[model samples]
Target: VGTLTFKDAPSMVTEFAAVMKKMASYKHSIGTGDTNATDETRVVDGKIYLIINPVNYYDIVARLTIQNANGVFVTNMPFISPDHIIQSVDVPVNKLIVFIENGYDATQSQPEKISEYKETFAMKRATLYAIDMLGNGKPVDNYAAQVYDIAIPTSGGSGE
Candidate 1:
């Protein structure tokens, strides 16, 4: 994990908008071997990289997405298991990282939003973030009752 210094919220928001415009032409990839695969972790002239480590409780599978503050969808990673990490490269700064409770049925009408974090990431830094659920025992149907937290790993910390 890299050390990150928080930028002023107002300035960061402006910068994020500009960066998003610049990134309009860039594409993102999922796994290796895709023709359109773009290495997000590669040091770009004006972008940041993020690695999200989601810690699940009660052996639940988490569905996560990244969205801008205006609720615009950026990207999503479905079915992230416990302790699994997802890397997003050249991401726009000051976006919201959201986690939704998994609804096994593919045809389910709506998925519930359990937790979210609005972050202003440091430029040129590959930052590691951990999202964790807080509660004891198994979860019930009302996922909104559950609490979640997002944090940066400390020095030498694995965020386990």
Candidate 2:
């Protein structure tokens, strides 16, 4: 049994997050989609980018435990603190870094319609996560879950 450590890649590095933010905003600027609008009655363009880090542990002892959105330490991944960030070049193929948001229950839902809303939100690819935050406003894995594969392009010039 070994301990597992997980850290939010983007959140850990402000630089990465800024890059994602720029990309998300760029999408909206180009009429992509909107996920950060205040009024639901109006359609908007663009979304706020988000991501998370979930580490799983079978049997382990943690020196630095990682906590979820609920303030509960992820039972699986253990001994992980905020400062723990994985080396970029060493990321595994199958193990992808993604984000998780607290599943919004639509606080204003009727009992009969509650499940429907939850079901839809769970599967909506367009929706971004709204996970509960820790006391310090850091995103914790709630119920909201969104996964995506990204290919970032960099600026460069080839010798002609």
Candidate 3:
């Protein structure tokens, strides 16, 4: 993992955009063990990468996305002012990450793919509220709600 720091807006945008593009796409590679991310040899790691950038860094709140082999993407978070700290929250496999911008606002809630990662194959169609999302970012349920995502990537995307 690498971090790019910039004082100017254009520099930030360009660098950030590039980083995001790299993360959201997939590639083919080969390794013998838990380290190999190129092929569909491992079921432990979801073969996908999601990259998201704060548009202009104007403000960032509520981030959401699927998960994969490399890492997780921004799902929900507050408007990212220079003051706010952006950190990587851990996510277990078979789950996605979702963070709402204003944690304080009850009405200003975000969306979570209810089906979540229930379907990892491309042929699997999506149904809203299919899975649920857990606010605490836990792989399991929260209270009576049991949060999740509306859609998830299918196994076809992995070139499987």
Q: Of the candidates numbered 1 and 3, which has the greater TM-score value?
A: 3
* Candidate 3 TM-score over all chains jointly: 0.23
Candidate 2 Cα misplacement greater than 4 A, ranges: 1-20, 23-53, 56-105, 111-160
TM-score for all predictions?
0.18, 0.19, 0.23
Candidate 1: segments with Cα more than 4 A from true spot: 1-5, 26-49, 52-160
Candidate that scores best on TM-score: 3
Cα lDDT of model 3 by residue, 14-68, tens digit:
6445443433333344433536555222121122222123331222222222355
lDDT of 2 by residue, 1-160 (tens): 1111223333334534433332232121212364563321211112222322232211111322468888997532211233332323343332334332232333422233222233465666554444442232322222122333332232335324
| lDDT at residue 68 of model 3 (Cα atoms) | 53
lDDT for model 3, please. Answer: 0.33
In candidate 2, how many clashes are counted? 13
In Å, residue 15's CA in model 1 sits off its true spot by 2.1
Q: List the residue pairs that clash in candidate 1.
A: 40-89
Task: List the candidate numbers ranked by TM-score, top first.
Answer: 3, 2, 1
Residue 140, model 3, lDDT? 18
- Where's the lowest-lDDT run of ten residues in candidate 2? 39-48
For residues 1-160, what per-residue lDDT tens digits would candidate 1 score against the true structure? 1122213334434543443333333345544455875533222222222233333221111223346799985433222232333333432232223223331123333444354434546423444444454433432122211122332222333446
